[model samples]
Target: MTCGRPMFPGSTTEDQLHLIFKVIGTPTDDTWPGIIYSEEFRGYNFPHYRPDPLINHAPRLDAEGLSLLAEFLQVGPTAQHFLMVAISEAVFESFGAAVQRLSDLSSLFEVSGISLHKNPGLRSSATLTGRSRQGR
Candidate 1:
């Protein structure tokens, strides 16, 4: 859903594809570098449609909110703005407080020598069982 309405609501895949194109339109080198060279994007047989503005698609969002959302929704992994930049740009009234709190927490975590990296097997049942047994 763009805001609340379905962006590509259809019974068939074709209809959905059409709607998808309508919303995003075509991605060019300027908008998305190297997209034209991707296997899926190359030699495609589809109708070209222009992109509808984010506001037009999601009328409920204000310009600032939409700008932030657009940054987050970039197609390329590197195209998206950094979290810090996005937050600063959005500039919530409590941003300073939030950043200070985060910094304090990070310092505490660093002093404790606890790595922030997530354990790859965290979701496995075996890991949970082992941890539970250790607690006993």
Candidate 2:
């Protein structure tokens, strides 16, 4: 759901992956800061209708986090070449279906350096790419 997701050009959802999270002390119902957004495309149709569940503060990596993540991916610990591009993104449900299938999710997470660690079960799930984890 996170990787391989692309948006239609000019789609209102495009480049919106790094959404602004609500401030920790802010009220849930409080109005947005009224920042100027590139005008919404009311007439536009995302013919491929999708739902949006934009979560705040999407998990990401800093230089340090990336080093940690890289070690987990086993592609190497100094693998800074990838995290800068993958770390920061909102990944709303809008992009899920188009990019989903058992294989893509596993592959994406592998690239993201998020294999199950510490969980005894993960030893197997680590090798179960292209398959959902639930069934195991």
Candidate 3:
């Protein structure tokens, strides 16, 4: 029932995130507001995470190839669960494609449990999207 939360930093993030620190190659501000993540201590913060190289897939990687990628991600000794890239689609048909692959992706993530969600103030079921509910 939780809408996976919107990252919503808007254009500011798009602009500021890649900005090099005037003094250094990194940013002067430790945090950039509107960076979407699960961290508390609400304030300015930038993307501070990196995928485990051993556990990550290069862009455009396919599902089966992602299996070994996920394994490497879960390979650390600690029981900590790391990150998974968020994937979104535009319409109901696209959503259908996402649901179809959820299993294989879950297997790659090495967990049986997952929940598909969307932004709040939106329908929980795919049936309510766009023109369907609008009668347009």
Which candidate has the highest TM-score of all? 1
Model 1, residue 38: what's the lDDT? 83
Clashes of 3: 8
lDDT digits (tens) for residues 55-102 of candidate 2:
222133345544443333322223344443343333212233323342
Count of clashes, each model? 0, 1, 8
Off by over 4 Å in 1: 5-18, 82-136
Better of 1 and 3 by lDDT: 1
Tell me which of candidates 2 and 3 scores higher on lDDT: 3
lDDT minimum window of 10 residues, candidate 2:
18-27
| Models sorted by TM-score, best on top | 1, 2, 3
Local accuracy of candidate 3 as per-residue lDDT tens digits, 1-136: 1123321223565444323221112222223323234343224454444433321223334564355334323422221333232332232233334333555336322322232435455444222233232444
Task: State how far residue 76 of model 3 sits from its true place (Å).
Answer: 2.7
For candidate 3, which ten residues in a row score worst on lDDT? 20-29
Q: Rank the candidate models, highest lDDT first.
A: 1, 3, 2
